[model samples]
Target: MSHTIIVGIDGSDNAQCALKWAISHAQKTDSQIRLISAYTVPGVNMSQADIVYPADFDAAVKKTIEDTAEAAAASVTEAGVPVSTTIVPGDASGVMVEHSKTADLAVVGARGRGGFAGRLLGSVALAMPAHSHCPTVVIPSTWPTRVMPDAPLPIDLPVRASGARTAEADGRDRPDFSGEIVAAVDPFETDTPVLRAAAAQAAIYGTPLRLVGVTATHILAPEWMPSEDHLVKMYDEAAKSFDAAVESLRADFPDLEVRYSIFDAPATEVLVSATYTADLAVIGSRGRGGFVSTILGSTSQGVLSHAVCPVRVVRVTRRQPGRRR
Candidate 1:
């Protein structure tokens, strides 16, 4: 089976940006590109309408799909890469998710037709990476370079072996974790899964993991003034949770080095700011709130749109019923 890099295209500017990034990466890795476009038939009832058009709607849609595919393929071909195209009729996110199960990587634009305003995460993009069996990369519109012609795309390999604590030349001790891992934890939510994933990735990368948790609160207080003690206590509470989460992962990764930070600003801002220094940022879909809640909280959505690095959204699939910590 050919390892493929799948991209969701809707002919939008953002989609094109994603397509360019995917094309470049695919070229570097010698991987085939599957440029996919999804279209939906407008709901119409022939009985209600008095006039009927001579041309068939399905045929028009088919032509549009083919045109989009050709355009995408042409771009990749210009870059000297081999690419194929597919057009499907259905939900865009659903189709991409199905294809991602077997693909090496699924790439999507930060903003799309279905994404929310104020940098809130796109429903489809957020959902796909959260549940995807493979690694997913959400490329933001403002990435420093739109197309990488000569830069070699970084590839992450799963962890292979375990080692002891050793100090590097930089005076920092080497971590037991093996993979490149970063964690984005919401302070309001219990961060068990985020911690677990980070530890696992660190083990795989054999690199240290950075754990970042954000707490957004109003700047003002009810009392005469917000005292230093109050601020310290708030941060202390957040720190306690951060430490607890890291501790739980310690048994599995004895040499894992975890760095935790608590930010008292908007969750999205804090997380995105940290992404400037990270390879991958891990975040939970919904926390505290049940499944009925939205896929991303306001902070997460903001970060999704403008993060400096790639984002990995972890969706909660199976949880112990009635279990609360």
Candidate 2:
């Protein structure tokens, strides 16, 4: 089977941004794009036998989506990328999740056609990534607002490198490959799948991979510790260990620049800020704090709720990757 990247489109600005992102990314990866549009008919009364389904209405909806998909396909082809189209009648999240089983990656917008302002995680965006069989990337609505820096990054103990961006002379969409790829490290034993996915993303966009190790009390918070200083010391030790881990793994991908740092802050907050200078931020569905019944952990929710750039949530095993300390 040919490699495929599925993109959920609803004609919203966020969906358009997602389409653009998927197109540019597919072009870089040489993967074919499968654009899908799903819809549901409201106010269907089963008791009314005389009432008929509106064929014209259905036809009109199909026409609109087909046109949108066509336009997207033309744009992708113009960019020298391959594209395909599909239309389904059902819940948008359900359809996307089903297709994700066979897809290389699934892309969606932060919000869809319906939702209130300030809502970062729409029903579709939240549901797809949680239920997807593969990795899912959700493009934030505020992505277009990103511009070249007018100020310096926040100075902190943990090292940071601002992925440079040179604004275009004419004001148009710039491909997202310009910034670095930020990946959250679990410290003890990183999730190989998530790290591999992040590395592949960095390699595809020709960007650097910044490994951020965050140690918080949420998971490793030992109540038995005498004071906060001890916890910080433990967190720092975990962070420094990643230095050797990356050293061994970076050799596997010589083309990618892998750098790592440790910080004593909330994992979600640090990752959300990283999105500002990162083309894409990747995290696992469950962190050290995740529960068995939880579909998404608290850290994933915090970052996905308020990120500027695109965020990806890769599925992890039900249990934590490494043994607890």
Candidate 3:
């Protein structure tokens, strides 16, 4: 796939942060930036019942968005990445989702100036991952504040890639540190694709793939595990799944340094803890057990909200009758 990354801008601080994050990523991957600034004609806009619509109101709104896109393009150009900007005439979320269908990745700020002004997570950030055609990354407001000119590429990987960083925060935090990439899984029927996504990411970064399978031991097993012996057998089965998954990735990328971990704790807790040391946390949008949900599963949401590193929530697109993975 071409390295095309789409990011949203709204003249908000968080949106600017997302744009800069995208620039940094493009620099690392030698990708192109498609900076999009979406504008909407407000319901109570000047054309309301009591007010006269200013002749220049529409032009002004378009100009403002155009300027935002131009400035974003300038920044990317200065950073040595080729960029393309667009002043989309529509709602932000819908415009982004539409572009996501043809892009390799889509990124959004945790929150922007919209519906709920003071909320930490915004409507667009929450909406994209669940509906995007590719992986969507939501950059938090509290990002690693390293100077852009001084930032280094993620690591020594042959594949072009971009990911999150655990900020010690360039002196803002007393101790800055680097971290790994964690691929979270449930080892259940639904998450095999999640595992593949994580493995692909690990391959891209040349990072050690950490396959963390989390489960709560006290939770009652299904009817098939009616006895303690059956429970033991289930545990053994899970261990085998863990190893097999790792082996599968190793088979694909012989040099990949993979690790297997099983924790008898909540899936959210394990993945969040992993994020502290992970540059990126990869998870499926749906799974069984704690991750059982339609789209944007509870477990995935927990990690997205709490992870110290950037999280990539990939939608496991089920194969259609005549489609490919």
Candidate 4:
């Protein structure tokens, strides 16, 4: 059961950035890097008029994928790390998600052709983190360059090593997340599933949870009246619901630490700023303005694109309610 870091590559500038970040991290952790590039075949029914170079399409596509993978491998090798490349044929997001289930950590770029138009299109990156069998890391294109000056990289953090144990072994100070977990809450209605997910992560990390509720007032501002009090009241009610949700989590995880906060700004800004010094930031995929068909909302997209540290976006799925005995 050796752990490997899987990175999704598409040969784009952003994807290249993700590959570089993954390679450096994999080297430091002594983990093998799996560079994957997926290519989709064009539909058979599409008119030849719409197609370009249909004669050599398959071969060209295969060559492109192989070349991209080789280039990625070469980049890592140049940095003195061993890496393996794989070229798979299928839908990009779906194939990446399937691979993510077995990977120790999956890394992907924040924006790409497969991503959303206006938001971080890192669907494959974000999806794996939400439902992966292992922990995942979504690397933004703007990551800071590696700080290694002159040294062979260290091995990966051992499996089953507790944070405290790792810190003690390294003689390095543990990060203080006692201040707040900063859970972003939607004002329209409190999503219980989202809160529960956030609480679980906070407890695992041993950080105090802070519930933050944000309301958008401009949408409902009537030109004649133009009062923001209605929105404030909505936020207040949502805050109360958030508090109640935290209480429920406390009952389940009795020893869990929790708190609450409220904000009147845009959800994205609130969540992004909250992640500045916080150990982890948690937010829901959908909110008041969420589209029924989308897996992520505008706020989530923004946070994933710009957050300073790791950000977890809770994805709500339908399941049978727990039976009370």
Candidate 5:
């Protein structure tokens, strides 16, 4: 089945990167790409001086939005993917969330034009995964190398904020692009949207699916210390659950290669580490540990901020009983 993928654009290098990623995914999945750019009226303070507005102010704004969307759509057309453009007037995040209700996937950059050097994620990037009705993919600023190695880097490289250092200056290691799709699955939880998405991505890219789970370790409190036997039981149950999940996934995708490992550490840390070598990392919007109704779980938040690879947040919510296009 063909899918409808939404690409949010804002004329930022990061958003351009997102467009590239979305086009590539669309080519692979035989999906259509919808390019959306949101615009808001300029909020200028007119208390000091009386400023006369131009007669064609609204027309100028609409023209600008149309041009921006068209420019982004050019890339999608060149990639031979069916594309549509929508210029909406609203907050970028709100626009994306509203459209995501019918989109198969939503893609955006980790940072946008207004992102501060110290900020790892842009406001839209943070909000989409939490409130999107479909899976939301956040492409990192450093993703060009993985998707298009020969392509030139964006000209407008962001300058570091005061007291900030570059990744190379801090001795950061680059990702290896191991060509495997990784999923941070909750073994004890029966939710399979994350797993199914990861498997489908793996198939699309012709890569192996790596299922990584983390077992909770004992917590130390002033008055309570968990017994060794209790910890052992928990670990054993987690192992069994992991095995069952792996078996089920293997059965579902018979010809696909599926592997799994359980780590005895925090979920966010382990998953973040796994992203260094993964082609893409798929995860659920929320997990079992935090608030039951959290729009975005703490673990997913941490990984999205720091993961070296593109992270897809799969949110399982009640549907309206039919698909949109």
Candidate 6:
């Protein structure tokens, strides 16, 4: 089965960044790209002394949206990837979520033109990850500037690392793997779909899988906590669990590098810190035991908001290893 990556394009530079990421991932996974754009028509009530659009107004707006999708698809096609386009009339986030039902993955920018200035994420970016049927990847608009400062803007271009091969020199399109794939590991929930998704992404990128476990000792402390002994015990327990998980993943992915870390800090602080050197940060939409939920809790929100690299939020329960669809 061919996996389809849904990319929400609103003709914004940020959305272009999302499209570039989708195209790159599609090339690596041998998947198809589905570019989508949504638009809404203002309500016109003839009952009031009010305004009404011309008969062709709606048609013209839809045609423009279709043209935009076509142009984006043409770019993806030129990149040698299977590509298609969908232009619908509705709210952008809702439209994308509706299409996500049949998609294997969804990608969007951290912020869009629809949001007000100073907002870290747009409404669509904020809503899709939590609502999408499949795993959703939100790319930061400043990603290119942060991770690939030297690369061209608003396009898919591999960063040239010291020991990495460049497409121009190797005559092959290869993704940059100088960074690691960081996955948030919940000590309470050792085995989760988030881990599986992160492992798959690590395999896809050919990067190291870093399992990060955070224990909020102070935050979870009792009102009359006596000493640091209890906190130390909690940290020790988390470390062991993280180590075991790392070994398990290493055995499962023999060819891939697997490592683990335990941080006695807030979940958001540690996870966001990991993203500094990560190719992608994967987190669960819900948290049961310790780490804050990505959607329901503030930790995931903080990481997604401030992460320098792209973040993938997984909400589904069982995931097939190494399979995006």
* Per-residue lDDT value at 13 in model 5: 79
Candidate 5: minimum summed lDDT over ten consecutive residues — where?
Answer: 156-165
Please give the range of 10 consecutive residues that has the lowest summed lDDT in model 3: 153-162
Q: Give Cα-based local distance difference scores for all models.
A: 0.61, 0.70, 0.67, 0.60, 0.72, 0.72
What is the lDDT for 277 in model 1? 46
Cα lDDT tens digits for candidate 1, 117-144: 1134565667676566555668766563
lDDT of 6: 0.72
lDDT of 5 at 40: 72
Candidate number of the best lDDT: 6
RMSD of 4: 11.2
Please write out the lDDT profile of model 2 over residues 61-145, one tens digit for every residue.
7788778778877887888877888888888888888989889889988887832122558877888767899888988875667
Candidate that would win on TM-score: 6
Give me the displacement of residue 43 in model 3, in angstroms. 2.9
Q: Positional deviation of 200 in candidate 1, in angstroms? A: 9.4
Q: Write the per-residue lDDT of candidate 3 for residues 1-325, one digit (tens) a residue.
A: 4499998888788788788878877776778989878886665654547776687888888998888778888988999888898776887888888999888888887778842123546778877888888888877665654223243223211011123223443434211124456777665332376677777677667677766665556465565434667656665666677767666665567887766555555677667666655677777776666554667777777766666567778776433111112
Q: Give the per-residue lDDT digits (tens) of candidate 4, residues 207-299.
A: 677666654443455765435675556655766765666566756779887766554555565566555446557665554442112455556
User: How do all the candidates rank in terms of TM-score, highest first?
Assistant: 6, 2, 5, 3, 1, 4
**Tens-digit per-residue lDDT, 1-325, candidate 5:** 6899999888787788888989988988899998888877665568966776787886788787788888888878988999999887878888898999889999999887632112667888889888988889999877766433232222111111111112221244322326678887765653377778888788788898877766545234658766778767776676677667667766557788776665555667667766766788998776564211366767778878877789988875432121211
Q: For model 1, give the 10-residue run with minimal summed lDDT.
A: 153-162
What number of backbone clashes does candidate 4 have, counting pairs of residues 3 or more apart or in separate chains?
Answer: 4
Per-prediction CA RMSD (Å): 9.7, 6.4, 8.0, 11.2, 8.8, 8.4
Clash statistics: count for each candidate: 14, 0, 0, 4, 0, 0
User: Which of the predicted structures, 4 or 5, would earn the higher TM-score when compared with the native?
Assistant: 5
Give lDDT tens digits, candidate 6, residues 250-320.
65677877766665556776676566556889987776555654354676677778777889998743222
